[model samples]
Target: MSRERFVVHLPVLATDLAAAKRFFFCDRLLDGRRRCPLPADHVGECGPSRHR
Candidate 1:
């Protein structure tokens, strides 16, 4: 009976999937802490989508 906001980010490329961001809702979820690994060409120094 309550609402919670969650944010998820995923990197999408025309050639391939670059990265993925996840939100862990429950302990029973599969790959709850899984994160999309960044590709060699991808840059992590940039912040969120706002920066790019």
Candidate 2:
């Protein structure tokens, strides 16, 4: 197998990333398919962005 480089733009902002992740990855968006972009043990009151 070989790797190729690609450049795809999402045209999004900081706030947009949060919204998209929530809407697409969160269980509330899909049919009970829960996902977290951040680590499971990393969640706190600060939020995802602050976790990183």
Candidate 3:
């Protein structure tokens, strides 16, 4: 196997990296899925701006 260099930006993703990771990772949570778009430890505080 060989490694190739490829650059790709997370288009309009959450400003919060941790949240974005969770979202993109598709982590399951209560009621459906975990809160995201923000690095929130809670379930309702979906803060941060993706465009930011």
Off by over 4 Å in 1: 15-52
Q: Best lDDT goes to which candidate?
A: 3
Candidate ranking under lDDT, highest first, comes to 3, 2, 1
lDDT of 3 by residue, 1-52 (tens): 9667675656766778876655562223434333344434544535443552
- TM-score-superior candidate, 1 or 3: 1
Residue 48 lDDT (model 1)? 23
TM-score of 3: 0.21
Q: After superposition, how far is residue 22 of candidate 1 from its true place, in Å?
A: 21
Better of 1 and 2 by TM-score: 1
CA lDDT for candidate 1: 0.36
Kindly report which residue stretches of model 2 are placed more than 4 angstroms away from their true locations once superposed. Answer: 13-52
